[model samples]
Target: MSTIYKSEAGGREIQRLYREALDTWPVPAEHLRLPTREGETFVVASGPRNAPPVLLLHGSGANTTMWRDDIPSWSRKFRTYAVDLIGEPGLSAPSRPPLNSDALALWLDDVLDGLGITSAAIVATSLGGWVAVDYAVRRPERVTRLAVLCPGGLGRQTTGWIVKALLLRPFGRWGLRHSARAATGLESPESGPVLDSVVATFMHFNPRTERLPVFPDEALRGLTMPVLVIVGGRDAMFDSHETARRVRQCVPHATVNLLPEVGHAILGQTEPVAEFLRG
Candidate 1:
């Protein structure tokens, strides 16, 4: 398959930055490579060996490092496996599978089977949320519980947001930073470095351009596992209010939280997510 990076040098720089970010992980982590049908998968394992397992799936354009701030707290109770989703900017393979099919479900099955995890609690954000939901619906018995932050595939994406993002591309760093902050609802200090990495990745890598597909209500209703749906009231990607409402209405056992002041970022909700996972 073709590479998603613009060039080899660009890919190396992104990888270097990724390694640098991984170094900042708050707790000790063990890096592992698991062979899968899609390709070789990269996972960062932490916490006790005997504890219950929790799988961490990051948003689009992000990798295992997305959980840097959350891993320390989660590792204290549960064994956490932070995966670098294949096709993203990480150590994982660059094979781009079809997003609208069961490819992701199959890929995840390979990862879990390779790791010998019979079942795990899934904690995901954005695109990763879509993967979690897809896997849960396809293999309900393998997922103990599901906790998603500002996930897609629940409601339609906003066209205005897409247009705004496209428009910002031509204006350079200042514009990119502004757009990133607006989408995340994050301000200076907290958003500075994060936005820098985000902008750098966009400039250097060829991120998937297709929008995440929305799942049908029937498909969502098929999920029998306990579900926690957290959406930001100010999220620019999708209609968070509508997403929460639909999830609550369709998934009878789901617990939905809509943070009015937040956007697409999940930085502050790690504790709540951990508490839910513990139970």
Candidate 2:
């Protein structure tokens, strides 16, 4: 359900699922609680009380609401679910450190089952994309379609800066404070609350790279769902060409596109993001 934060009168923002997703500049939808197998409920969102099901995941340091600017319109055509990753922040319950990849994916699977969603089109970016990839490999039956945006763990090239920041956690927050310009592809205070949440998630719920094993190339090759890989052309973290190559090599059936202008986050506004979701 769309939680109404605050907005000026005559705002262009549309009422979608959560106030953050749309009114916030990306997309907005309502919030819902889905229980994990452990009986802990994870905070997630779905479109208008009734739209085609689609699960949306946030990038690193970000929570489910980060999709605010891009998801409301899509909600008209599909039920968009933005997940607050357990251990990250927001509505999901946290697990103490040392969580494994299989546990994470299985808990996500349980969340979907708790939501009563049999299958969903998954749209994910950054760290969330890594989770999506792992889930697809572990449980293909639950995913109907997958769109990975600048996904990590592609087994091509890993940026030392990213690995350091994600692993250290504290340095990541310091970097966010000073590097707001480089933090996200889209620039707008419309994204402030979400960004703050991201910073918090980074500081507290950050994952230790060494803790959860990174996904191998074999895992990418195993996904049977139709996969769409989108990497920003300007993303310095991972070479777009390398990303495309690795994606093609990993998922033989993947449809790949490299966007020269988009950054690692790669989502904003409606049309471009919606195009991928529609596909």
Candidate 3:
């Protein structure tokens, strides 16, 4: 889980590969720009039109480019579609998105209806994970499997000061849009084209921390997918161990993996995540 891509050149290589892969990502015949009740355009970008789909939801304040790290590996197994959550950021239109979980779920449903995706395996990170649980709790039939990475919305009350400071505070959002990229080992700014992509993620996807649902434990407890729960042993944003414990207790059937060394940064946890995707 803690493999290092040492040297600026090494990191740049990954970025180079990513840019090339995206250039030829093969957009579907007719991509849809679904209109959510909130009046936003949820952009859906995907692979081959007919393959069984996998939905990739990026973390809060980040765009689909964050998936630039995992897409090559993922798009191989499942026809993947990375969506820009309505109202949160990216190319999605409406400035104000729904802060409530129920409305968020409706937005997702609209996205699926517009895309013609009846069912899929969802892979979500942090805030994205929160929405996935909300959807599983509401419309389990639409999702066949779920994989969440160090998800959020467990209990904001139990959250550590670091995460609360970064995600909960406005400054935290700015730091990532301006800072945290390097802390996540995306140091090759010129190589990976980090500045532009990361800034776009911040501008378009960053959520207003005050807007999303709070303390989402009840909805998670009601989820019914073949859930694969993952957490970094060193995660400081949310309690990784507590998250694993509570999720196991809530779902009973969920598979949990407590990875060593890695923290809230999922981009660097590529190998283990690659295997997790395969699993």
Candidate 4:
């Protein structure tokens, strides 16, 4: 079995489910695999051929499936590329390079180049948010606009949930389900399928444990493009308040929204994010 999964059978099961999800993608999409320095990257491209490009990046432990709910609306207005981040639980390669190095940005450069895109608007969440910000900082001229959801780097990473999850692990499936809900903040009945997917993925997927390297204020200050940040007040993974504050303090012109009732997983903002990307 690959080190990224618990066992060979578990990995195969997860891949089977991912394939099923891709087959039912909400819109017509072209599944493209690009050769990058990191490895082969998988992307789901949709919408008009002539529309402006909008890149979508999902958080860690996730793939393009996370964008299914938002794709229909956004794709109508723009050519959208939902990229499966390298090393995550997706069809992409399992090469996880050091986050602190310039490798990720360079890898993104290759992705954009391979797609024939010079610049594009980016909407990213969680770990993907960190990546978007990092790329924007390193290649500000290439990012027309940026919107991040519960992104890391700016906030203080929280670990209380880790202890809670570990304590509940002894309870088995019940514990795992509860842990998924707590971590994702998806407790509504409508989110049952998503929660179930999360549980199934975590059963085999090994998530990254290293803390994200924080972007210095000097780096953030260089983002001249329009920026939007949305974080949940009750986020279990990072301090949302600090993230909001840092965005305001460092990128003074950027928009910041902190939803009091949400958690690490911020959903149902397809319109808001699409509007921002449109502008």
* TM-scores for every predicted model: 0.96, 0.73, 0.72, 0.98
- What is the TM-score (0 to 1) of candidate 2? 0.73
Give the Cα error of residue 153 in candidate 3, in Å.
1.3
lDDT of 2 at 158: 41
| lDDT by residue for model 2 (199-243), tens | 444333334344224566777778888888888876745566777
| lDDT of candidate model 3 versus the reference | 0.63
**Over the stretch 1-279, how does candidate 3's per-residue lDDT look in tens digits?**
001222445444444544454465544323346766656554445555566688878766555666766666666656777876554434555344454637877878887877777888888887788788778778899988888887876533234434533663466546654444433334444435655555533332323545335445676776777788887776656667888878877888888888766656655555655566566
101 Cα displacement, candidate 2 (Å): 3.9
Q: Residue 201 lDDT in model 1?
A: 81
Q: Return the lDDT, model 3, position 83.
A: 77
lDDT of each: 0.87, 0.63, 0.63, 0.94
Error of 3 at 180 (Å): 2.8
Clashes of 4: 0
Model 4 quality (TM-score): 0.98
Query: Which model is ahead, 2 or 4, in terms of TM-score?
Result: 4
Candidate 3: worst 10 consecutive residues by lDDT? 1-10
Give one digit per residue, the lDDT tens place, for model 1 in 1-279.
238888888899889998998887889888989998889999999999899999999988888887887888999999999999999998999988998899999999999998899999999999899899999989999999999999889987876656677788788877776777766667658667777777788666787878888899999999889899999888888889989989989997899999897878756787899889987
